[model samples]
Target: MVWGRTEEGEQVPKEARVVFQPGAVWPEADVHADSCELVIVIDGTLEDENGTYPRGTRISAQRGTSHHPRSSGGCTLRVLYPDVVEVQRPAPPVAEGGA
Candidate 1:
């Protein structure tokens, strides 16, 4: 599945892990069209559809779902997206405190 690493001589994906900064996200939406996903926030915090994800938080979502994830104070995540898609959310509304 992934570039290299395979299991049982089959096309199984190898074990993988990665860390993303505040405004980063996973790409490669094509393959993720019908796959479930899992994301474990190992450290720090993140913003999602419901709210924020603190350390030790394990978030799960359905396949073909979408979300805009961001870590304001930085975070380290262990993510497993059976497939990956880039979900974009609208920017936050500007403050009315004048420029």
Candidate 2:
């Protein structure tokens, strides 16, 4: 559950917490900018490309970084976002007279 943004107001998320069922994975792995996200494993196992994180493990993702989090045996996570609003990365410059 997210206690950051409500139905009204600034629409900025301050903090978030979630409980993942066994074999559950986050739906989106989109990159985020201008936001620092931290994930703490409360129980079970959390898996990422780097390795598998067990209980009491904490991972920090700084601004302009992204993470893909998943769990095999279920886990509880506590996340925080200093800046809830995400900034999109700028597109590459087009070539001169390119198709």
Candidate 3:
């Protein structure tokens, strides 16, 4: 859920509570060009290309950074985004030995 805006009429950023089931894979995506993202692990474990994060872990993804998040045993995360981020999905792998 997104938080309320600031008294000055500026946005207070967006927040989300995400639950990832076992074997869940979140696609790799770039952080918004003008915003950074913060993530806190609440339970279980979350893994990305950089490393694995367990409960109580805090992650800061700067603007223009990318990550592919997944969970092997389920996880809960609190994510904060400055604004709605655009996802950039990776290109599908080409099939081999076929036309």
Model 2 reaches what TM-score against the true structure?
Answer: 0.68
Instruction: Give each model a TM-score.
Output: 0.55, 0.68, 0.67
lDDT of 2 by residue, 1-99 (tens): 443442244455566677889989878873655467788888888997779999999988877776677888999888777666433447999789858
Model 3 backbone overlap count: 0
Q: List runs of model 1 lying over 4 Å from the truth.
A: 1-15, 22-32, 82-99
Which number leads on TM-score?
Answer: 2
After superposing all C-alphas onto the true structure, candidate 3 shows an RMSD in angstroms of 14.7
Give residue 83's lDDT in candidate 2 (0 to 100). 64
Writing each residue's lDDT as its tens digit, candidate 1 over 3-70 gives 22122232433223556676665453323334566778888886766788889988877866677776
Clashing pairs in 2: none
Error of 3 at 84 (Å): 7.3
User: Which of the numbered candidates is closest to the native, going by highest lDDT?
Assistant: 3
Model 3, 37: alpha-carbon shift in Å?
0.6
- Candidate 3 overall Cα lDDT vs. reference? 0.79
